[model samples]
Target: MPRTAATPEQRAHIREQIRRAAVEVYDEKGMEGTSARAIAVKAGVSVGTLYSYYANLPELMRSLWAEPVAEEMVRLRATVEATPDPLRALRALLEGYANFAFDNPDILRGALLFVGRVQDTALAPAPAAVEFDQMLRDAILAGQKTGQIKPGPAAQIAHQLWAGVHGALALPINIESLDFGSPKQIVAEMIVTLMASVKA
Candidate 1:
């Protein structure tokens, strides 16, 4: 007898299973060692089956992170927009970003690895990354207009804010030997310093 085709639900389940396996392999082997065959073996599927779901390992990794990052950006944007004070809105945005990174360390790590590997000049910025940058720029611009933040190029200020906060969060993750104390407190202090530098 011919086998029945997989239902949508079953297909989704299988896809998720493959993603979980990929994450596990990534954790164990890092980006340099992870491969389609390893993930397929971990997922209990053939390489052909894995290819059918994802064109390649990079595509599989992108699928894992793209939606979560986009959703978080939307939530952060709403948080920023709700605040009447521009300075507070910027604070809220940075805090929200810190919270997301802390809450989803594995996803964050996976995303960083995926991005580092795929940094080709020909590739366009990911939609979520572009949205995140624009959100920061918008907050910075609003603050500058109101004399809450110092006058400067909005894009430059946005980059400073993003880079500073991201460095604070990424340091402990990359250098575990150092005593960085609480990441939350570190980020809060970093925010304060960054805001002070840009304050009008």
Candidate 2:
């Protein structure tokens, strides 16, 4: 007899289970400690079945790590476009990003840890990473044209601002022992500082 076809919902369910399982394992036992077999067991699927969904561990990690950020990036792009005011648009965009990072602290931590030591081969350019930077660069350029921001290289300024966000968010997530303010507060303050510093 031919195998019964799996419905789209069933496939989605299984994929979600696998992703959640990976997250749990990665959380409990850092990325290095977790394996595909562990994730399969946690997901209640055979190793073969897990492989059917993801070719390997990195593929699964990539999906779990990058998918949400990509979605956020799309939303941010739309939100910024909707508001023609560059200052308000940029504020909203940065705030949205900080909220995302704050909400998904564990995932952000995992991503930072995983990327730091690993070679470039481990990560593809995140769509959000590229798109967010581009949007930021454009915002800076706009501000410059309006004489609201200093005239300089938009790319470099964008990089500095982006780095400030990532660096501030990363410390709280990575070093659990270190005392720090909430991620939201840090990000908000960082956003203000960065914008103020760039003002003409």
Best by TM-score: 1
Could you give candidate 2's per-residue lDDT for residues 83-163 as a string of tens digits?
Answer: 887777767877777788777766666654454333243546656678888999888888788888888999998888778
Clashes of 1: 0
| Candidate 2, superposed: residue stretches over 4 Å from native | 1-21, 35-59, 116-122
Q: Which residue pairs of candidate 2 clash?
A: none
Find the 10 residues in a row with the least total lDDT in model 2. Answer: 112-121
Highest lDDT among the candidates is held by which one? 1
Cα lDDT, model 2, residue 192:
95
